[model samples]
Target: MKIGIEGQRLFRKNKHGMDFVTLELIHGLQQIDRRNEYVIFIQPDSDICIEEIANFKIQAFSSLAYPAWEQWALPRIAAKERVDILHCTSNTAPIWSSIPQILTLHDVIFLEKPQTTGSSKNWYQRFGNQYRKAIVPTVAQRCQMIITVSNYEREQILKTLPLPQGKLKVVYNGVSRRFKQIQNKRELINIKEKYRLPKKFILFLGNTDLKKNLKGVLLAYSIFVENSETVIQLVIVDLKQKYLSEVLKELNLPGLQEHIVLPGYIPNRDLPAVYNLSDLFLYPSLRESFGLPVLEAMACGVPVIASNTSSMPEVAGDAALLVDPKDALLLANDIGAMLSHNNLRQRMIRKGFRQAERFSWQNTAEQVLQIYENTSKSRVTRMAA
Candidate 1:
């Protein structure tokens, strides 16, 4: 079958969760399926990471805006290429397309009520959420199949939208091979020097999003620091210093910045070293479809402390210590406990390794390929009828 995969943000320099998922999917498919012809659709940008293989093609289409690119240009191009099935890896897809489309709706957090005040402060994020709100329901109704990341998110989607019984599929995300525990002393030292990381630190991959529970983390960390005998640093990635300063001001803990390290954006390739050098990893998000970072840290042999709500419990299993994200004191206490007890920390680390092994990108790709073939066959049968 001729397959078209929408990977519009694959070429961007700073890729987020969905972008990485799409990139891994393409890599997985390339490794396994050489017989089926594949076409990848992306918007032209920097960081040209993907290369064309024997049976795969990379097509770049430039547009002034994201909505214009997806809604107007994408379908027209896919139809012109005569693609048998077009898979939109992101949440939104072109609604008017006739080419049997499969949408990977990672989560429906946009449709639910906003959890925290000022969560959507970033203009781009706010616009994207609004666009998904307007686009996803219609696309979900028209698409051939809908793929979500976790069972908790699947139920969330069903509670909000009325999808058919068999339309939604749950395929878990995988930890990249690069995230495994690194033992090279020199390599670890290099990453530490590059990021100006302290000897002992707790890693929190935080940003400006309110759902990330940044406020809660800061409150918890402050409590942890005040109570602990040893001084430890907090390493936060992809967070701007200016916004963090503002948050510190609001929280009335201006002095807390001294213990916090803002290393900005670290490339995916360099993350494993950072994870390995850290004492603990924090994933205290208010909600998540699939908490990918939790597994990434676990794969690096770092113990984790994550929120108890949403799909976190399911994804984290019994590997990481789970606590209420809203209660700052509870999260703080767990952080101290995880750091203090050697036996408990080592036991959790072993369980984390086992949990992280449960998911793989190859398995995800195989399931997606099956869906494509089934979709193609069903389309042909309908045309014959």
Candidate 2:
């Protein structure tokens, strides 16, 4: 069967969760399945990460606009290639594809009721969310199969949308093997110098998304520092100083300005070192379908302090200290205990490794491949009938 995979942002340099998941799926498929013909559809990208292998081919298709690129150009190309099954890896997919489609609806958070307070999203993010809101329902209803990252997200989708039973499946995301503990002291020092990281710091991968709960983290950090004498810094990745200033101002924690470190954007290759060098990893997001960073930190042998809400508890599984995302005092207490208790930290580290081992890209790919085969066969049976 000819399988067409929509990997729109896979070739981008700094890939996020969905992009990394799609890329890893493709890589895993390449390693496992060589007989089936595969065509990867993508927009124009400077990075060009994926290479052509035996049964896999990369095709670049572009349009002037993002929506048109997916809705118009993508369907046209997939139909032209006569792909047996088109798997849209990202949350959104073409609404009018002639071929059988499998959409990976990562989350339906956009469909939730808008918060009373204004959103923290910038113009681009707002536009994307609007587009998803407009298109996801129609496309989801029309698609042959729906793939969600976690059971939590699957339940959310079913609750919000009118979909038939057995239509949606949960395939958990996996962490790469590269995210292990880095023991080389010299290499660690070089990475620390490169990012200007403090000797001992807590890591929080922050962003502009409201659900990331950056302000909550900052407030929690402030509380932790106020109660403790140790001068531990908070290293934030992927957030700008201007945004940090705004968050600090809103939290009324001007004193935390000196204790925060902003390393703009760290590449995926350097993340393992960052994880290893940190005392603890904080992922206190308000909601997530599957929190990848929690697993990544665990794989790196770092103790994690994550939110107890959403899929975090499901993912962390007692491997990390879980606290309420909104409760700053509770998060601060957990952080203090994690930092001070040596035996607890050691136990968490060992459990984290075991938790990380439960997930693998190979297993994810195998499950997806089975879905492809099943969908293809079912389509054929329908056509015959």
Candidate 3:
């Protein structure tokens, strides 16, 4: 079978969760089915960057508009390639296509939490009822198969949309092996100096966007530090400047300013060391399909404290402490408990390692490949019948 994958996110230098997802899927595909042909569909400019990316053919297109490419150009390209199946790591597999299609919907965050991003907010603000009336039903009726990152998200998909249960698949994500425990003492020292690391710091790794629950994290940190000032520090990375400024102003904090570190956008290569050097990982996001950072932290032997809602508890398992994201006081108390109680911290660390081992990109890929084979055979059987 000929498999085509969406590879646009490769254009980004600092790839996020989706980019990693696409890359790992390809890696697994090549290992599982070397004899079967693979075609990676990339953006035109990204072609040069991904020339060495895979041992497969690449179909490239150049376009700045995301929705336009998916709506208009993608199906034409898929048909031209005579692809047997097209798996979209991103959402929406061209409104129409001759080839069988599989869509990887990261989350229906746009559907569930419309205010989370600018476009969704605009769509809802301008045409709230009409947009939902038009798009939601269209997707439920037309799409062949649905893929989500976690059981939590799969449940959401099933609940919100009227679709057959068989079409939905839950394939968990894997943390890159590169994000393992830090070993190099000199590298750790250099990273500490570079990012101005604190002696004992609890770390949060997400953008400054409000939905990531940055404000809540800051309030919790403030409360935690006020009660026990000298125990550990708080590091906030990848926050937008505007949000950072607002958070600082609201804090109106004094010497606590020194304790709060905002080191912007750490390189992916350095994440392992960053996780290793920190005391704890805190992810207070109000939304997530699967919290990849939580898994990455566990791999690095870092104990985590995450929100109890959405997909977090599912991702965290029993490894890390889970707290209500809305309650700043409860969040603060969880951080305090992790920091002060030596026995609790030790137990979480051991549990985290075991939890991290449960997921693997290789396993996910193998499962997907089996689906492709089954899908192809079913098509053949239908023709025969």
Candidate 4:
């Protein structure tokens, strides 16, 4: 079977959740399957991370616009290659493609209420969300199968879209093998000095997205610092300084800036060390399809504090302290307790390691391969009939 995967943003230098998911899926497939022919479709990027394997090929297409690239260039190329099934790893797919499509709809956050209006989101975010809002439903209706990361996200998709029950599949995302406890003392020290990390700190992988609950985290951290006697700091990764300044001003906690560390973007290879160096991982997102960082942190043997809402509880399970994301005082108290109590922290660490062990990229890829095969067979059957 010739399986085509739309990995548009896979080669970008600074990848996000969906990009990493797609890349890992491809890697997993490469490791396990050698019988079927696979083609990865991606936009031209400076970072050439993925290498061509036997039975797998990487095809780069260039376009100034994302929609034009996916909608026009993608379909034409897929047809030219005679792809049996095209699996779009990201949220959206080519609407006009005749080949049976398997779409990985990571989340239906765009379809949810309280949608971000003008000025609420930056131009790129606003454009991407709007594009998804416009194209996803139509693509979802037309696609042969829809894949989501978590059961919670599946339910959310069902509530928002009228797709049939049989068409949706829940395939949990996996943490990279690299995210584990780092034992090399010298390497750890080097990474610590490089990032200028605090001696003891809480790690929150923050971004400009509203759903990340950055403002809420800032408020909770302020409350924690004001009440607690500990000298712990909050280390935030991937957040821009300009946005951090705005958030600080909005929360009226400009004085708390000294306690916060913004080390900018840390590469994926260095993340395990960052997790191991941290005292705790805080991921109090208001909404998420699947909180991959929560699992990554847990895999690194770091105790976590995540929100009770959305897919987080499902993902974190009994491993981490689940708190209401909106309740700042509650989150602050939990952070303090986790910091001060040795037994509680140790117990969480043990549970987290066990939980993280449950997910693997190899498993995810095998399940996805089954979907592709089934979809391909069905298409053949339809043509015969």
Location of the lowest summed lDDT over 10 successive residues in candidate 1 = 112-121
**How many steric overlaps does candidate 4 have?**
0
lDDT tens readout by residue for model 2, 1-385: 9999999888778888888899999999999998899999998788887999989999897789889999999999998998999999888999888999999999988888776113556788789889999999999999999999888888899998999969999998898999898878999999999999999999999889888988889888999989888879999999999988987888888879999999999988889999999999999998888999999999999999998888888889999898889899999999999999999999999999999999999999999999999999999999999
* Candidate 1 to truth, TM: 0.98
The C-alpha lDDT values of all candidates are 0.93, 0.91, 0.78, 0.92
Candidate 3 ranges with C-alpha deviation above 4 Å: 44-55, 113-137, 250-256
> Residue-wise lDDT of candidate 4 within 269-373, one digit each (tens)?
789999999999999998988999999999999999999999999999999999999999999999999999999999999999999999999999999999998
Model 4 segments beyond 4 Å from truth? 115-120
Write one digit per residue (lDDT tens) for candidate 1, span 329-375.
Answer: 99999999999999999999999999999988999989989888888
By TM-score, how accurate is candidate 4? Answer: 0.98
TM-score of each: 0.98, 0.98, 0.89, 0.98
* Displacement of the residue 10 alpha carbon in candidate 3, Å: 1.7
- Using TM-score as the measure, the top candidate is 1
User: What value of lDDT does candidate 4 attain over all alpha carbons?
Assistant: 0.92
List clash counts for every candidate, in order: 0, 0, 2, 0
Local accuracy of candidate 3 as per-residue lDDT tens digits, 43-100: 7652244443344787878666765677678778888988888887765556667777
Residue 302 C-alpha lDDT in model 3: 91
Note the residue pairs that clash in candidate 3. 44-61, 208-239
